[model samples]
Target: MNKVVVKKIEDKEIVWFKNSNSYLVLEPIAAAILLKINKNNSLEEIKTWAFKKITAPKKVVKKFIEDIFLLYTVNNTLKKEVQNNSGTYKIPTKYYSEKYYSIHNCIFKIQFQTGFHLLKIHPIFAHLETESQNKFHFNYTIFDDKDFIVFFKNDAFIGKWNKNETHLFEGKLSMHLIIDIYKKPETDWMGVFHASAISNKKESLLFLGDSGNGKSTSLALLNANGFDCIADDFVPIDNKKNMYTYPAAMSIKKKSLKTLLPVYPELKNAVEYHFKKMNKTVRYLPPKNINYHLKLKCKALVFIKYNIEVELEINSISKIDAFQQLIPDSWISPLEKNVSVFLEWFLELPCYQLTYSNNLKMIETVTKIFNNDL
Candidate 1:
């Protein structure tokens, strides 16, 4: 009997580590070994069992199995949920740069203590920046506190981000915005996906891939062709499974310069920012034709890649494999009910692995998907 929730999807199994609010996708043999982990299974026995399942260096395999066993099979508690609460740290509000934005008709006044923190988030929402004499629904303040970058929602202490972990900072802000826009608590969100998403007005198509796998570049291409960019980097899906709009700029990489040059000629002279921590150079491209209040059902989950070796190919991938790729990079709800909803919505979605080299054909295939032609 496994202590965690293990669901079989095709050839892989997703092991839910509820204690840590985490998940692990395993190969069959690893899954078998993981289920059997306990004091009863000796170190040598588990390592020997792991040997029969996969091919690797004996010393490497032994170390890998030993680490896994010690991490889970031992009495040591599994990795717990990391809290980002701001404890004992306080900073005065300077609000040097202030702007107001309206999302879903809700006004939010965003204030930055310095321009450094402002540029991290301001560019994407620049289009939404507006002048308001009306009362703000919330005041989001971000400031550098020497050791960490702190965030506040309506002056209430929420959380702070580690200096090295800027993604956590932006991600938390994105979630807070989602909560404010939907008028729901943080737990109401089904999941936040680390993917670039675009829509055809009626519905959406979410592109999931590792960083530098052409997710944002594909979005910039599609936006030029026909689709509307919904969200980039952080996409939120509600409990009902509808994908809401996240008004943010598309961070296009330097390698995509020649490819998108024809579509966006102005990008040649666009200011570039080097994200040193992430080791990626990017330029922000504002989204176009987006519906400010649109909430759309997704039509497909595409794991895209720009492969110069091949012309173009779009193939159906196993939902299990897709979930394995998805779960690790995503933030799923810890609540049991919301987890159930996430699984239900995820399993039903059509998953595809799209590899393309030709721009026109890639756009055509995506258009066909939106039209339900494929």
Candidate 2:
């Protein structure tokens, strides 16, 4: 197996250009692997080096590599890179919060803020990096061969981890921080919808479709061409009705290459197959305006359908019918017993069901709707 090289780019992202066209956003475990392998170290040397650094048993180092590789296989999209034996590099951190944890094709870092009962990943704005740059927000006293805990300012929450239960608490606490602390607030402040939000300057278009309906593919194609990609799989809309965006960019699948090739011929070889479940996958973030936040209402909703016979047709559906079609695709569902809030939010926006055959003409058809204000 060849050693892969890792380089630190931007402030948060780590790049491994040799493996795949896209960058692998590192978790602490991945970062630790990179630190173990410098440019000169061979695979055997890496095993020996790991044993030297930590006073573990002889087989610990070998198993460590194997276990981490398995993790990447099951939970990570970088499984192909590891399988290909492309030498990889990682940036290590002692303790980081999962809220700021941006894994390759899986999650997004919504917001990183400190509270009385929360653990944080990034520095608290500024002020204390010089004091103890390695210090963490929460007091994480647990350790697996691959996991580390950073202490947080939340004294009460930190106290929950009794000695025997510390490891379990570390995983639980990270999850709690992400859901109760980060996602709950962000979802309220910005209504987090499970749809792709694509925009130019004047008009922002949203594609609300059932899973595997090419929601992510359409967004990726638009992004590759010229328009801004707000969010590939999930969109964030503010309380005052402004939509904020985050970067979770990926690419289209190889199977769908025929649909996209007519519109954008550049993605021929660029189409990489990701085994993960996300319909919209970011293979690379080429030079394009990544819209971090967009203050636009849900101007138009287009339901996308792909087939061989139908030419691209964007028809105007009645408001009631539009709401019925769009509701099913929303993050909130009628299946949930309590859906008042979701129905309220849904009524405020305009909706459309766009039916089309698998041709490139849908782009122009949708463009005309925006022009006509239908």
Candidate 3:
């Protein structure tokens, strides 16, 4: 009974729904049910239509519709409040300095107290602040009765904040804010990729792999060899297929400290963080000679695998295979034109699978591939 916009992305095998400021991804069957909803359609009519199309039973369809209705109602209410409260804020108990930054022309204002040591360690954002109009902003402040809170412009709390333990909470809040500002529906970016990127100044190489597959290690090695590090974990691709550098600190695991320390002596002073989820100790190090604001066209896609028992090797793969491997880790924009342009740029790149044990051999193989010698 609610008004919503539904878009079918047949190429991606997913349907997108935009309800106010919220976006939801639904499968074909669920999407069909959503499409059946209209101003005139009763709940029984929608259920009857869904049963005719979907193979599910009457009870399953009923539950599905109930879930969708709940989600839609909750998200719609939040979206309306967020939109109405934009550019308005309540005075905080403690005011901090507001810093402005420009990323792909989208402005973000981050306000944090000088005592918040977490902000000081994030050197990647050091050079990004400049005189700019604020498009999105969040304020970090502490209260007399409560703990620290990162408040949205509407004074809505971003997340749970504690005064005693603040590092991990603030770190997550910062990432959430970054994603919010960069991945807005009105932005021109195609989408975000869970891949690391490095450039030779002329063209960029994107390294895609699973979470523990050495993407950051490979990028660190390339950076040590004079390649410009574009992004460590998430790469933002514009509508034009240009990859923008996300200069977040690279998280290097303790296992890699022996090999990477030789190349980057600065890692000796890097702060150690124990990631409870991964059960690993990591050091967040700033990429070497990184330009915080740089965009490069992707020239190659490499799927990397690090194996202690395997010899170094690089093999070419078809575009179809590359796409199949990349789709799982990629968050493609629901916009039809954006998806088309991204596919064009992606298919134009040469794809390769690189397996290696030693970093030196891996570097050599990558260099040869880049030079067309492989």
lDDT (0 to 1) per candidate:
0.82, 0.48, 0.67
Each prediction's number of clashing residue pairs: 0, 20, 0
**Tens-digit lDDT track of model 2 for 1-374:** 32333433223323232222222445444556654552444668767666766666778768876665553334323343212111221222432233323222223232222231232222211111123223333332322222222233232223233334443443444333434323444335423465777777666777877766777677766666556776655565545556655444434556567666776666664534343434444233232475443466666777776655666656666555555455443443212112333334555556676666643566666556567644
Worst 10 residues of 3 by lDDT: 10-19
Give candidate 2's TM-score. Answer: 0.47
Alpha-carbon lDDT of model 2: 0.48
Summarize candidate 3's per-residue lDDT along 203-275 as a digit string, tens digits.
Answer: 7889998878899898898888978888887787788777877767787888888889888898898767764
The top-ranked prediction according to TM-score is 1
The candidate that achieves the highest lDDT relative to the unseen native structure: 1
lDDT of 2 at 353: 68
By lDDT rank, best first, the candidates go: 1, 3, 2
lDDT of 1 by residue, 1-374 (tens): 23455566677876665556667777666666666673367777887777887689899888877766765644235655666555665756467788898777888898888877887888777767889637988898888877789988876887877878987888889899888887878777899999999988899999999998999999999999878898998899988888987878888899999898899988888788887877988888877776767889998899999899989999999887788799878999877677778877877889999998998999999999988898
RMSD of 2: 22.3
TM-score of 3: 0.62
Badly placed stretches (over 4 Å) of model 3 are 1-92, 95-186, 318-320
